[model samples]
Target: MLKKSLLLFSAACASASAESVSVYFGNGCFFDQQHTMVTRFEKLLLKRSGSDVTSVSAYAGGDSSSSDLCYHNEGEVEDYGKLGHAEVVELFIPDDKSLKDAAKVFFEDFTQLAPGQWTRQDVFDLGPEYRALVGIPGGVSGPYYSAIVEANSEVHNLNLKEGQGGDDDTIDTGVVWVMDSLKFPAYQAEVCLQFSDDNPAFSEPYSEKYHSLRDALFEEGTLRNTTCPTNYIC
Candidate 1:
């Protein structure tokens, strides 16, 4: 099990000039075989949120240690039957965006893959649309996600495994967007998806990465709600 570290914080503050933000992705069966999946997630997050976003896995919803960060992988038995799972990511936006707007950017970009068969190439193709929101703006770049070497490396390694399919193989998946700011201590909101027969993606630990990916896609199209269930700790 990975030990808990101090919850990551962004250097930018949610003041008049800059903002600190965090988005928690929930209800996908992230498994041991999917280490690459998680790694890719972090890379995309860092690219979209900025070069400094911090991402971590956690047992959110209703695990005994839900408040504490939990290791996300096949080896963690406690995560097997839990209500759901979560990935906490912190982002720093300077001057131009609000945490709320950043959250919307994430929702919009991710939802593109919610339905139909989309590839990472599709994500890359949306670079222009995401440039103002996530990119360096006006800066000449070879690739959209070329800000960090680690992210580039992970993207490169994604091809190391052959024959694995896209996100169509997983089960139900969804995400709840909650933002807390030091500037506004009382501010909090929950944005989650409503589950249905066709789109049943809520966060959970998976035995394999493929299962998790499908569910993760399911979550993108679901509706957002203000409330989290008793079983869920959002």
Candidate 2:
């Protein structure tokens, strides 16, 4: 009986291993409120994915001030450096069906919360940078949600390097989400990832994606309810 029980346990472990899928999330530098928002988002994702999911990870980091600089002769130099702040979120799905189910749930949940102007395809295409910049009041403009969708669509098919630009043909399946809230003097942010590891070289430059997303989100008045941190000073 003991031997039989041990065999059963081993089989269960193997079954679990066969069904798991990995996911990652990255949140570029942000304050406390932003962090709370990201946590909530992760919880929601877990709920949608269900029990078959195995693991979850998140990466969070960002800078207080805009790193843009001016050069007399050269084009305007935008530094856009990160504060080396980041968090990671990861989730493991049990099988292909579970992965698809989780994605569907993510899309539905995201669409429900975001304004009617955006769709799942749009959000997926936006990537992390685009998502962070979304709803910012006075920020730059770019294809925010669209880029995310595009990246996600191809994430499963590519072999991503830590920091390389030539893989554009493959889906750039990495992202960093940023959020900020001034209330309670709280400065917090969280990062989530669909990938396995943290490659600063690749992720550092990805901060621009958050910058763009933040700009767009602010422009839409989505962030008006939140206050900027006095310490960060924009």
Candidate 3:
């Protein structure tokens, strides 16, 4: 009887170990701009991990109102789309190996956006500030195509203003670079990630690298930290 009970307990543990990991991607207002990037990122993650990543989903309603840093009492509730500051992308992994593999891919792919890749001189001019905003370590030269790299960097000392008492005078410094030229209007892209579980195995290095990218992007002025009262947009 004891042998049979032990077998049942071990089976239950094994089943639990095989539980699925769900990944979710949320995009606030800039859904269209973020779609292609997210798609590319997702494909890369799947390819690198060689794990069973089940599906990818998008939500269009905008970030949750309660978390907005610029929240106002009289603001029109219908403007949810305009008020949202960030978008999200999520993935689910079936096991630990899959999760770790996906994370490794994420780090590798993101690091490739360094300043050395810009091909145009005009865009290259703005690379430093872009790097500063996104917290990239060095500078690059060439064209604006590298702006994506800048936008993928970081923002530092994010301070939120609430009511009249909070620090309002501080115009939180971030990297900003102009991309518009003789032919085109200036544009920028920002990317960020949020994980559901606090798995220590996944959080540490991922967070560090993410912060580096955030600094680089913010330094370049392509990404801004709009996380309000809460440190997260969603």
Candidate 4:
């Protein structure tokens, strides 16, 4: 199936008309134990959506397996930089679909992890200043701000599913969904969001800070209402 998927992706890439969007996984590494999780999510988006969405992974670290990786610096560097090692997953969305809606679907599904996984996590709707700092473009007027949600377990442990490792190994980790714009017309327009944190999830005011932000985003429509598709996978 993996080979088949790649072939299909290649064909899609060859086509002249294909829309694209980039999703930055802050503190996210493709080689981590949970790498498959994001890949599966990517496939799901394409399968369920009306558009032909193909994705590619870009890493900000050495190719060596033992190299340092994680979201060490997010939004602080010129190149898709993060505080820790991270991966930028680019999604090519078909022209027929709204990139906004496609992104909404990805976020909605991500937050739907197993009950235990989400129960302790706090979600945040980033403020305008931070939103603009990342990639989400817009003023305080529209529902354009991005969301930063808490991860239920330690960065390393969270990668594995329920039974893969000790299920109880949970920690405070932050992830966000961002939207950006593309400069040239090759793929036309582009929007990207980075899910990043500085290992401050367990920190004093930061934890409380994000929870409060989550509440505000919901109220302001930054994190608008999204219902899961009847047969969708979380």
Worst 10 residues of 4 by lDDT: 183-192
Please write out the lDDT profile of model 3 over residues 134-203, one tens digit for every residue. 1011112323224334223321112111111111111112222211111111111213322222223322
lDDT of 2 at 99: 43
- Model 4 residue 203 lDDT score: 31
* Per-residue lDDT over 127-203 for candidate 4, one digit per residue giving the tens place of the 0 to 100 score: 21111111222211223332221222212122322111001212222233232312100111011112212234533
* Model with the higher lDDT, candidate 1 or 2: 2
lDDT of 2 by residue, 1-234 (tens): 101111112322343566442333323222221222323442354442222222222222233222211111132232112222233233344454544444333333222223322222233322222222111111112222333344435433122122111111111232223122110011112111111122344333333432343334233322122221222222
Residue-pair clashes per candidate? 14, 72, 47, 23
lDDT score of residue 37 within candidate 2: 31
Please, what is the TM-score per model? 0.29, 0.27, 0.26, 0.30
> Candidate 3: deviation at residue 183, Å?
44
lDDT, candidates in the order shown: 0.26, 0.27, 0.26, 0.26
